[model samples]
Target: MEETYLLNVEGVKKKILHGGQGELPKLQDGSKFTFHFQTLKDDFERTVIDDSREAGMPMEIIVGKMFKLEIWETLLSSMRIGEVAEFWCDAIHTGMYALVSRGMRRIAEGRDPLEGQKHRCGMGNMFDYHSTGYEDLDELQRTPQPLIFIMELFRVEDPSAYKRDTWAMSKEEKLAAVPVLHSEGNRLVLRREFAQAAAKYQEAVICLRNLQAKEKPWEDGWLKLESLVTPLVLNYCQCQLELGEYYEVLEHTTELLQKHNDNAKAYFKRAKAHAAVWNEREAREDFQRVAHLDPSMAAAVKKELKQLGERMRKKHVEDRKRYQGLFQSSQG
Candidate 1:
């Protein structure tokens, strides 16, 4: 066995495996460190839970961002580039490891790491009572066990060394960026980039929702925030319609209509989804309502109703022929 020496970096223990070549450099806050990490369960070094290397990428964090395990910052702070070490992190440090690993995994897969859970208030909330809803993550939340991290120090740079995107921004920064995001989303929608457009609108919705959560519902402040979100939410629903997420369109538009009965766009969008799914009666009613609310849409509704009538007629004829064929087969 290689000589094992125990060193405490902010109460976390590290057993140096191989100290890489070159002299260590000075590290400070906002210093960027990129490295690949492998996490193992408990003292069982063979049972790997997560590995950045296997995921085909390394993780990077600005020293002060607290992006990953805080102990990671401390441990990485001590190593030079190309160094390899195994750090035994306590529950306090590894408690949020599961969530961080989830994000890292998502990034490696080219998906948004913050997908579906962007409404979380802070990193603390990631470990809060809210289960990641992922079974493995829930287990980690249930048991804050110690973990072993095998890491290779890659490179360290200053914060100014790389461009910062919206993901790296704080809450206030994100909220401030909402207008830019909304414009970008609108641009994407115009370009027919439905998926990316949906993402941008959804991110804006998340920001607005987080802001609204802080204020009482229906209050001036809350309504003001909601007003800002209405167009974005509708835009998101519009993209969902194009993406064939009909049930989602129905769900959100229904909720939207319940709150604002005169929302012609909501009625129109919902009616389109209803028509797509062959909901004739509901679609007719919604279209009628939209025509009543916004007379400008009446011509469009007329054209849609004409096409729907033809489609329904053809469908009924096809159904009758199929039934007749089945009846003859059974009789014979």
Candidate 2:
């Protein structure tokens, strides 16, 4: 197919590798488009940078959501479903590619995509952080250039087709939803519905995190949001503990303690998780830390330590019996 310039979209040229069915669908606000994309350098080598296919999931972007790579929405809107096309976007349109790629990579790794982001624009962040944590993206950030995008439009869904995720909500909407979610979570907890309660707490935490990501990290705004996140996280950890997800409890509590080492509740929760996981030494250490941090928790810590000791003793006896039985059986 001959290369074509998108109408009124300067600095971008498109060529359809494979024609798609029907005309371009209505790309309305809140419409979701799912597509697999490969980002390549414009050089002869066409060095690959990012591939949603390699990430094992197609990318989904909502229309008119102020996505980082606005050019992508423009490129996708020009195509039909099942279309495979390549677009060469000029440096201006591709400037935010590195930032978008970093978030995509983090998502592929099962991490918080907004974990390291700050209240800065794409270019501002590129200059501030000096790296996307990926070598290729860093080079692109260092020297801006045009890029080639090979995209396959797989599916399109209207806004009403699915529930909106926290990321899809407006800032005001997200902020409004958090307290409602928190209350529902509390209600669920009262009903002993731990798993459902955990989901609510997690959703609220995600909403807060989404808000916090828009603020400079460790600043007053971010710290204030983080303070709100703490209680929700602790509540989530409590549910996980009740659900016997000891490892998850350990992970959450450890992360919490890393930021606030003096949080007695975190240390206590972590101590309980450690005890459940049979890490006697670690459990004892955390329990001691809890006692030191909050004198009021001393009695509770002592009780936990005694229970831990009893459980350990019981486990030892069980192990001894099993080993003795094995030895006897082998001799026989």
Candidate 3:
């Protein structure tokens, strides 16, 4: 006969695989818990969905931090340091696991957790992408099911025991950090530190995004936050242009242009990127748009067009000569 201890929370049962020494730690707000976890399907095979140990890092959760998977916090709170326990959580508590895992996986892969969510909220992103780009995660998203989480608690730190990074900050804290980061980025740009400036600007954009995720998509509050993101992204793109990351510039500027068609600066930067990448027709079109949008840029556009014409003409001549030589050699 199998036995399980019903947790204080409903629809959850825990089984201690390995007991830990010492008393239970305080579970105050901001207390950080680091543990290794293996998420398994609650079936006969007990299929593993994710493992933090395999990822070479333990998972972490700060109490009362409003983590997407609230059940993890509850599960962790009931354990002592060095304890290993398995918790079977109902589908209601596990439904958001896929979304949470998607973010974690993206972090592990060194990608933006919000890569495909440039201008939308998290729910909007789920509706649009319809997949986490991972097979298991997508399956889980499609069919919500109960899950077994094997958690090995390792370390727990009090609220003031460690420094808090931006990701751990509250919404108000994040809002306060944005302007400071923006100014830092501007100062770095003034020093000609394009890479460092880009990082700062990108960080500020992320802070805004985190806050924006809480608001409804395209609503007044969300749009207000998005408005703040625009200038920071443009600044980041400017740094990319300086660093010769033309494709990155193109990608960001194109997204910006899609939303704000009248953005002359976006068009101008995109035109420069297109010219650098030898997208002649695209460059010309963007340059023309820039001129039309902001008549003050007419002289600059004219200069760019002259330079582009000269460069393309030289390239064409070189290509024709090379082909002619190849043709003659082949005939001989």
Candidate 4:
């Protein structure tokens, strides 16, 4: 007689060994099974599409999209009759229904769908996911899963006001009000507002450098300063270059190259500054340094250097001929 067994593999519910007259085997949660069984010659394997409509199965579906059951079929193909398999699915599978439900809730609350999705997906949270506050009508309707889980698990007092206040402040306001200047600097950099961001970065570097200078040479302070100053200096140079402040770019790049002679970006930026000031010799030197430090830049640097040299030689020849002609005319 043929037999069937309902198995709970991981969190997924599946039926194995269909068409049995005997009683089905019950596999409890976290139970392990490993067995080999022979199938009757007449029995044929059947394919079933498991979805939310299927009994004892919870699956997510959108009207137009392909069913995700194909993924489950591929995973199950390797399973032996008695082998117990355990696996995990990501947000695309496990959290799909929850995400859609939350989105629908936002719509019911008179919130824009796009705004609702962003908040539910935790897009606005840069630092701590829990501390990231939300604002507007949409954010007010949603709660982060982790936060809600924590509250439910521990039965903690509702900190609705506290949470609300946190999300109430926009990312811009939060960055500006951040106590650590460097964090605000980083936020600005991420937003591509480099000039305004450079100020905060410069201030942070200065503060750290001062601390390093005050402390003894062997102290941990200098190490911290080195970590902070290097990146900040690089960013400051880049910002100055972007804003067409070539002199400031040269100053920052010069200081950086002093400490890190092998830094390719510093050489490149310094070369740009030199080129801006019509200092071809200095620019060529820096460009050569960059090409040497990073072989990938060699072709571009060689091309620019060749062009610069040709322009300078042509200009020099023209100037010499013009001066010589003037001298001969005066002599005449």
Q: Report the number of backbone clashes for model 4.
A: 7
Write down the TM-score of every candidate: 0.71, 0.72, 0.76, 0.38
TM-score of candidate 4 against the unseen true structure: 0.38
Instruction: Report how far off residue 258 is in candidate 2 (Å).
Output: 7.7
Cα lDDT tens digits for candidate 2, 55-93: 999999998899988989889999999999999999999
lDDT, ranked from best to worst: 2, 3, 1, 4
Query: Model 1 Cα displacement at 270 (Å)?
Result: 0.9
Q: Which candidate ranks first by TM-score, i.e. highest? A: 3
Q: State the TM-score for model 2.
A: 0.72
Q: For model 2, what is the C-alpha lDDT against the true structure?
A: 0.91
Model 4: lDDT of residue 48? 19
Could you tell me the lDDT of residue 8 within candidate 2? 98
Question: Candidate 2 clashing pairs?
Answer: none
RMSD for each of the candidates: 5.0, 4.7, 4.5, 20.3
- Write model 3 residue lDDT over 6-121, tens digit each, in one string: 64589899989999879998778788999999999989999999999777888889888788788898888889989999899999888888888998888898898877765654
The candidate, 1 or 3, that scores higher on TM-score is 3
Candidate with the larger lDDT of 1 and 4: 1
